[model samples]
Target chain A: MSDKRGSRAADRTEAIMRTALELGEEIGYAKLSIEAVATRAGVGKHTVYRRWSSKGALFLDSLLSLNEAHLDYPDTGDVIADLRQQIHAAINLLDRAPVGPLYRALIGEALLNPQVAAALNDHFITPQAEKTVARLKAARDQGQLSPDFDLDLAMGILSGPLYFQALIIQKPLTHEYVDRVIDALFTGMGPRP
Target chain B: MSDKRGSRAADRTEAIMRTALELGEEIGYAKLSIEAVATRAGVGKHTVYRRWSSKGALFLDSLLSLNEAHLDYPDTGDVIADLRQQIHAAINLLDRAPVGPLYRALIGEALLNPQVAAALNDHFITPQAEKTVARLKAARDQGQLSPDFDLDLAMGILSGPLYFQALIIQKPLTHEYVDRVIDALFTGMGPRP
Candidate 1:
């Protein structure tokens, strides 16, 4: 299509996604509707359909294209310090309402729906996991971690506590747990310095 | 109420809940219906309402009454071994397809629905938490754990990683993660021994 039409479509798609995100927050995932998003976006239903096929697809797009990226590491050449900083940063994110609820809802929804699950695994988790891998690789390169430290196990170690807090504990994501987990992770689990 | 009518009502309620549970696994939480359960149970729709007020509650009763009993543990002298055994037993429960999927679905659906969430929190988590507390207290009394260790934190340390693997890793609950977490938990944060 022409440049002008492409730009127009992009704007309309963003608007629809914005509306869907809001509706998803307000009414919850089970009640989310494409029609509601179209009405809220002030776009024609056919135009909405031309882009995404269903509510799940629209919501997937909305979730994937979110602007809020996770906290990136600055690499101060200290792995332990970097991990502490990162854990504290995660605490702040989990404490934030918009980020936490959306995350919980998305994770919950993805568990049941395969399309949404695949979209999330490929689009959302892959990017974040890559970033985490880079951080761990940087530590390994600097000889901060053991040469044999598995990236996947490191992922499990760092992330296991945070996911535990969000899913099972179902309490306020406190800085205290972050401190305990981070302390246990670096000083306790890793190779003796 | 006559004894015959009361007994008939109780039987109908049981039938409806059982049917709802079976269908809940067959379809999913999203597609469960009271009408279908009533038809399958060979009971009038009103009979379902005479017990559970809605589809959610009916499904809750069905799932709740199933395998509701906690694992019975003998007062074995070794607390650490008993706790390890408990984690292993939980992993066994998670390995079953019907029990596992139904649990994840139940929790996910509970996150979306407030009433279900309340029921799940009260009926499932609270009681399990209490059982865990009892076991941990027994361990503490047996002079196994550190004197100052909080039961909640200790429990979190033991079981949190297992939940992390099953839900986040989306893997079949493995014996490896289970034993790894158990080993780490027993060692405490203080020493190599």
Candidate 2:
């Protein structure tokens, strides 16, 4: 009986988060409010306040849920294919309407708000970032890559283009672009003569 | 008589832009206003209005003048050296308090305003992006890169880490990061062994 109530509460919380994310897109983060979220979710303001003490905390939780930041770990046995999968996931993630603008606001907001930034970095950005690193390590253990390479640098190489596509170019990330970047980064940019 | 008045108007325009950029730092874009800029620059509101229809446009022009995006082109014989100079210039440009936030806000505002978005893309982002592509083409012609490279992919590879470090990391684009990225990218991601 007790467990059932807890599970129901968790479901409701999840519902609130979903509603909040929808509201974030309909209105900018600057305009997002707890009362608005609660009203939209068909819940009382007390329910929202009890769960999330601060709007930033509420926004942070809602954002993490929607942004798909700590994305799925690609487990394709082929290391290169796995990286391609990771990059592909990034492209798809950015296709979500909320992802791009929220991220732009989140990063700039993070510049001034340390707590939100810390939550985003720990629970959101760094985890997805480290997933590729871990996979690269696994590849290294299998002797798929040269022993001398820096795993971190390799991850950066894979992730760099995706971030630039999203944050800088501010456009839809495409598969064709991803394949070529992966091909080029893996092949080398040195004098090809 | 008209020539003297034109010269004075140009001086006033420059003063207003310089003042607007400076004030955006001390206050912030959210709070920035044309009247405030006029007050600080000791110019009349009509003077600003006659030049720029709105605050966003004024700020846009101010940001361009501040960054001097017009002068970013480098004709150095070596593509690598030209990019190094640009990266160094970016480092210097970002050292200013308002440049980072102002640029972020401008881009963010661009998302909401179609005209502004078009202007930013057409005038600022695309031109800057294409300049890098032009340099990459020069490199390819000189046999510095593989002939099969996609220009967009190449741009992503080169600028990705630089953008990540500056935007995501929010750290200064240090010489160390620059050198590492340039070196790793030139050699490719996987280890050389």
Candidate 3:
């Protein structure tokens, strides 16, 4: 029965994390609460405190709970195509209300709250950013891009427009807009004769 | 002379806008007020009320006050050089605490407040964005870019990275980083040989 106990604990943890994400999206980080999360998840308040030190800690874990969505980074051999697909997917996710507001709130919180910022940077932001870098480095290795191509700059060119349009400018993150942005970056990064 | 009265009115308007921008940065939008702004500008509160309908309106005008800094959109015949210089100047402005926090706060406020968003989009965002598009169109006309280039998308590629870095990612806006971004976009947007 020890194994059963472990699995039950895991299930409870999953439920709590899922509830935290939902509450975070519905009401936002500013209004999200540990007490609400405990009651909604059908667990005791101490259960949450046992796992997370504070609301920010709980929210950070909830943010990571959504990372499964990013696992399928496209790798179709054509680096440009893969990059475009990945960015398009990201834009689509951001367009969804459940994910978009939560993400923006997290970013705003990151700007104002150091603990939240550190959690996001250490757990969510840096790892995902590194994946983008790795993909570009792989493309560079395959001779799909120029030898002198700056990987960091190429990564920025590829992803920057999407975030700028969707997040900062608050524009509609449509497929057409994504294509235009990708085409512009690829033309800039294409192999020179 | 009537000229003396006109100049005094202009000076008062300038002072009010300046104070609004300063107070907005020092505290933030949530706590900013017309009364405080009027007091800071050495004008009566009714004077502020007479000009602007609300604090958001006043702050929007304050934002426009800084637009003179961007008036010199370089047209030196070298489109790439001019673009780089323009973007570099923008990055520098964003890096400063005065304009930077105010800009970020506006964005944050925009997410939560529709009135502020409308004011920003109608006045500050759209008008400034059009100028960038105009500059690119001028370059395309000069054969510095392809005839078929999407001017809107090109604008996103050029400005998006700077904003994505400084605003969202909260990275330091360095001259070297700006140069790399410009080089990447120009390479993508350069005339297809």
The candidate scoring highest on DockQ is 2
Q: Model 1: residues >4 Å from true position, as ranges?
A: A1-69, A74-81, A126-158, A183-193, B1-17, B42-61, B188-193
iRMSD, all candidates: 4.9, 2.7, 3.7
- Docking quality tier of model 1: incorrect
The lDDT per prediction is: 0.66, 0.73, 0.74
Q: Predicted chain A of model 2: TM-score relative to the true chain A?
A: 0.81
Top candidate, metric TM-score = 3
Q: What is the full ranking by lDDT, best candidate first?
A: 3, 2, 1
lDDT of 1 at A37: 82
lDDT of 1 at A42: 92
Q: List chain A TM-scores, every candidate, in order.
A: 0.78, 0.81, 0.83
Q: So what's the TM-score on candidate 3? A: 0.87
TM-score, per-candidate, Cα-based: 0.72, 0.83, 0.87
Which candidate should be chosen as best, given lDDT against the real structure?
3
Summarize candidate 2's per-residue lDDT along A1-193 as a digit string, tens digits: 9999999999999999998878878887778889999999999999999977666678767766754643666766777787777667766665566666765566556655656566666656677767877887888778766565566666457777877676556666788778778878766776653
DockQ agreement of candidate 2 with the native complex: 0.47
What's the DockQ for every one of the candidates?
Answer: 0.21, 0.47, 0.42
For residues A1-193, could you state the per-residue lDDT of candidate 1 as single tens digits? 6999989878887888888888888887678777788888898888888877666667766865564454566588876677767667755754566656766777787678766666665655556677778987887777666555456555555667677666655666677777676555443422332
Instruction: Considering only chain B, report the TM-score of each candidate against the true chain B.
Output: 0.80, 0.79, 0.85
Error of 3 at B179 (Å): 0.8
Error of 3 at A86 (Å): 2.1
Residue runs of model 2 more than 4 Å from their true location after superposition: A39-57, A63-70, A98-112, A143-148, A154-156, B1-6, B42-46, B49-54, B67-76, B95-98, B191-193
Report the lDDT tens digits of candidate 1 across residue range B92-146.
Answer: 6645677678777766766556677767656655676777778767766766655
